[model samples]
Target: MDSTRKYTAEAPPLQEVQQTRGPLVLEFGTSWCGHCRAAQPYINEAFTSGPDLPHHKIEDGKGRPLGRAFRVKQWPTLIFLRDGEEVERLVRPADSASITRAMARIEQN
Candidate 1:
């Protein structure tokens, strides 16, 4: 899958993602969000290092099922998972290091 691709529809069930093999990154935010846009470069840089990692960019807003399930309260929330289990999360990461650190958690698992 395209690491930079953004999903506009509702995200898959958290349980489904959790059950999926390998590492995954669930990114919650809207395309129009300034915070999300600002963090794109860092996010890209981190994920680019692991081209095989699945990065799901889900558009989040009020009443969105997946976002609600994850209890997302901020824009650009990155949830790292391995074997469908949450490994780490970063909200509004300030730099590539922060994103890289989160990605490392998944790699280490």
Candidate 2:
């Protein structure tokens, strides 16, 4: 799977996400979010080394069901999943190290 960079306004249904079978990264935030923008570099850096990882850059806001399903209360929340189950998460990551660590956890699966 490709590592997605652009945030899509459309997100997959919660059920579809839960049914996913491999390592996936769900990033919840909006293009207009300052924290999200600031975190992109580190996010990109991490993904550069994760070519096989499937990533969904979901645009999030009020009334967005996918974000709500994850109980996201902050921008730039990275949820790492293995076999459709959450393994790690980072909120507003400050550097690539933390992001890499979370990615590693999921990549191991």
Candidate 3:
């Protein structure tokens, strides 16, 4: 797990993301989004004790192909993927339990 958490504006292409192996989490949101900001604590807490998987905080907005490819409509959408296929998802998570639960699902696979 990454100790430094921040959303990166430049994200990999949709095709490249789909080709990833093993479990990973994709978090989509802008830096200034309130809902995205509010969810950070929960996200952080989950990662703190959760499995050491690749977690990417991608800055998403207009013209972002990766977000659109995943059909993300809400900020801070956490997509749990195993072998590049989605297993579970959490949107605007309010608690670490929910995020942990979602991570568990993918970790199980």
Candidate 4:
């Protein structure tokens, strides 16, 4: 997956994406968010280190169903899941290390 990719305004249902096989990273953020843009490099680096992992950037804002389901209250919320179950979450990560650490959890499971 391309780490620098932009999220769409509409996304596949959260439950549907969760049902997908293997490890998945669901990133909730808006394109106009500064925090989201700032974290892009770190997010990209983490994904670069784990290329096989599936990463979905879902545009999130007020009333977005997926974000609401996850109870997202901030930009750049990265939810890590394994086998359709949430394993970890990082909100507005300050560095690549944080993201890498989260990825490690997914890798271990």
Candidate 5:
């Protein structure tokens, strides 16, 4: 994985992502999802800050291993985790601003 890019698929391992003080940001959606596709660029941009936190993507729809584990019900849901525990989540985010804001808040906690 490119260190500077937001992941478009499976994110870093949970333990690795939680190693930092900052929270981990995950984009859980498949490539075919329109909303997920749209969110890609912004998700990439969010990583530009490179906040020293882990950023990952798990591209799965229904019935897949990761999808079932996360219990994702919508496309393009952004899940934030702190210390391996879910901290914030936004489904089909209204905009990148909201997603980034959520990340910032989660990182603070």
Candidate 6:
């Protein structure tokens, strides 16, 4: 969808994510987290620039109720959701290849 912009969990009801008929990858991150910051560009580059997947970013902080609901414990956690349910998730990218591969998999489904 080319949503190069970030999204908040509070933006809307999440049930639609699963019912939309395509895949959605939610990124949980915090601003100061080096791993999270490092992964952002890779996500954009991989999805928006390359495969063109519908990507969304959520910040783990007091204002982000959705992050709290997801129980995000670390930075740059990639969660693959299809039909509003979690299908796959990677806590942290071991390397660039793995990160892009994760997104690629999400794009595939």
Using lDDT, give the best candidate's number.
Answer: 3
Compose the digit string of candidate 1's lDDT tens values, residues 59-108: 99988888888889999999998888888889998898888887778877
Best-fitting candidate, scored by TM-score: 3
Q: What are the per-residue Cα lDDT tens digits for candidate 6 across 1-109?
A: 5534654544334555546666677777766778876666666666654555666777667656666667777877888776567777878665556656766666666
Point out where model 2 deviates above 4 Å: 1-4
Give the poorly placed runs of model 5, Cα more than 4 Å off.
1-22
Q: Let me know the TM-score candidate 6 reaches against the reference structure.
A: 0.70
Q: Give me the overall lDDT of model 5.
A: 0.66
TM-score of every model?
A: 0.89, 0.92, 0.94, 0.92, 0.72, 0.70
Candidate 2 on 18-101: residue-level lDDT in tens?
999988899999888999999988888888875468889999989999999999999999999888899998999999888888
In candidate 1, which residue ranges exceed 4 Å CA deviation? Answer: none
- Candidate 3 lDDT tens digits, 21-79: 88989999988999998988888888998888898889999888899999999998999
Q: Local error of candidate 5 at 55, Å?
A: 1.3
Q: Using TM-score as the measure, what is the rank order of every candidate, best first?
A: 3, 2, 4, 1, 5, 6
The reply for model 4, stretches above 4 Å from the true place, is none
Q: What is the C-alpha RMSD of each candidate to the true structure, in Å?
A: 1.6, 1.5, 1.1, 1.2, 3.6, 2.9
Displacement of residue 29 (Cα, Å) in model 6 is: 1.4
